[model samples]
Target: MDVQGVRAAYRRYARHYDRYFGKVFHDGRKLAIEQMAILPGEHVLEVGVGTGLSLPEYPDGVRVTGIDLSPEMIQHAQTRVEDLELPDVTLLEMDASAMEFSDASFDHVVAMYVLSVAPEPERVIAEMRRVCKPGGRLYIVNHFRNANRIISSLERALAPLSQLLGFRPDFSLDEFVAHNDLDVLEAHPVNLFGYWTLLTAAREPTCRGGASPDLERSIRSH
Candidate 1:
C-alpha cells in the first residue's frame, strides 16, 4: 500500500483495531517485550503504534515513543496513554520512512505488523536501523513469505492485491534482513499457527549468522 492508502486504511481500522486485531496480535506483542528484557529508563521506539495496544506492557520506568502515520490511529494511542496514565509514553503522527528523530535516538526499536503495510518497507526499516543506536535491538514482528512452496506461491499471487488487502502477503525475510545491515540474533514463527515471524537484530553490528559482509556493504553504499 502507498502512504496515503495506509493512512486511510488505518484511519478506518483505528476504532475497531483493538477489538478485531488485538487478540490475534497479542502474543507477538507480549513476546517482543518479554524477549527485550528492557531495563527501567531505557528509551524505546515503536513504529506503527496502532491504538497503543502494547503501551501498557512496557515496564513502568521505560520511556516509549510510539509513532503512526494515521492521525486517527495516533489519536487513539494518545488516548490510551492518557487514560492509562502512562507518563513515560508519547505518541506521534509521523511517517516511518522519514522519522524526525535524530540519528541513534533510541536504545531499542520495535515494529509489530508494520512492514507489510508500509509503502516502502526498505526505507521504513532503514529508518529503524538509523534511529536505533549501534548494538541496540530492533524487533520486527510481521508475516513474511513462508518456506512452503504452495503457501509461498499463494502469497506471491496475492502480492499484487496488497493495496486492497492493506498488507503485502509476500514479504521476503532473507532480503529484508540481509539488506538492512542487521545482525540477527534469531528469527522464528509466532502467533496464530505461525502466521507471523519475530526477527530480532542488532542495528549495524558486525555481520552475524545469515548476514554476509557483501550484503551489508551494498546497503551501506546506497
Candidate 2:
C-alpha cells in the first residue's frame, strides 16, 4: 500500500480503532509482551504503536518509546499516556521504515500488527534491527496469509484493496522471515482462531559500533 494511502486510511480509523481492533487483538498484544521478558530499566521502542493500545501492558520502570506514522492515531496514543500518567513513556509521529533513533539505542524493539501494513516491510525490520542492541530481543505480532488453499486465495484476491483497508491481507510469513534474515527464536499462533501470530527473535551483534554518538547527541539535545 502507498504510504499516503495508509496514513489517510488510518486517519479515518484512529477514532474507532479501539472499538474494532482493541479486543480482537488484545491477546496477541499480551502474548508479545509476555514473551519479551522485559527487565526493569530496559529501554524499549515500539514501532507502529497505534493509539497506544499496548502502552499499559508494559511493565513499569522500563523506558518505553512508541512511534507511528499517522498523526491522528498518535494523538490518541499521546492522550492515553497522559491519561494514565505513565512516566517514561514517549510517543512520536514518525515513519517506521526510516527511524531517527541512534543505532543500538534500545534494549528491545517490537512491532505489533505492523509488518503487513508497512509500505516496505524489509526496511522497517532493518531499522528495528539497527536501533536494537545486539543481545536485545525483537518481537512481532501480525496476521499472515493463511495456509489453507481457499483462505490463502481469498487473501491474495483482496490484496488489491489494501489501500482502502489500510493493510495487505496476503502478506507471507515465510517470505518475510527469509527476506529479513530473521533469527526467529519462537513462533506461535495467537488471537481467536489463530488468525494472528507472534514471532520472537534476537538481534545479532553487528560488526559496527554501538549507539552512534552523533545521532544520540542530537537526540539528547532535542
Candidate 3:
C-alpha cells in the first residue's frame, strides 16, 4: 500500500480502533513497554500510535511523542491523552517513513503493530533508528506471516486486500529484521495464543562513535 492508501484505510478505522483492537492487543503492548524498562525523564517515540490505547499505561515522568499518518487517528490519540491526563504526551499526524524529528531525538523508540501497514517499512524503521539515541532500545509488536505452511499461504493470499485492510497480512519477520539489520536481543510470541510477536533490540554502544548508525548504515540517505 502507498501512503494515500494507508491514510485512507486508517481514517476509516480510527473511530472504532479502540473498540475493536484495544483489549485484544493489550498483552503485547503491555509486554513491550515492560521490556523497555524506561527510566524517568527519558524520551520515547511511539510510531503509529493509533487511538493512544497505550498512552495511559506510560509513566507520567517520561516524555512520549507519538506520530501517525492518519489525522483522524491522531485526533483520537489527542483526546485520549487529554482525557487520561497523560502528562508529557504529544500526538502528531505524520508519516512514519518520513518523520520531522532530529537525529538522536529519543531515548527509545517503539512501533506497535505498525510495520505491516507502513507504506515503506524500511524507511520507517530507518527513521526510528535514526531518531533513537545510541544504545537505546527498540521495540516492535506485530503479526508476521505465520510459520505453518497452510497459514502462511492464507496470509499471502490476503496480500491483495492490504490496501483495504490497511496492513499486509503476509509481512515477514526474519527478512524485515535482517534487511533492517536490527540486533534483536529477544523475540517471543505474545497475545491470544501467540498470534503476534514482540521483538526488542538494542543499538550498539559504538553507534555514537559513528561506527554504525541507523543499524542499516546505508539507509541514512532516506
- On residues 94-127, what C-alpha lDDT tens digit does candidate 2 reach at each position? 9999999999999989999999999998899989
TM-scores of all candidate predictions against the true structure: 0.89, 0.91, 0.90
Better of 1 and 3 by TM-score: 3
Which residues of candidate 1, in runs, are more than 4 Å off? 205-222
lDDT of 3 by residue, 105-219 (tens): 9998999999998989989888888899987888999998777789889999999999999999998776677667777777778889687888887764223322223222222
TM-score of 3: 0.90
Judged by lDDT, which candidate is best? Answer: 2
Candidate 1 colliding pairs? none
lDDT of 3 at 63: 95
lDDT winner between 1 and 2, please give it.
2
The global C-alpha lDDT for each of the candidates, from Candidate 1 onward, is 0.85, 0.86, 0.84
Residue 88, candidate 2: alpha-carbon lDDT = 87
In model 3, residue pairs whose N, Cα or C atoms come closer than 3 Å (at least 3 residues apart or on different chains), thus clashing, are: none
- The local lDDT score (0 to 100) that residue 35 gets in candidate 2 is 86
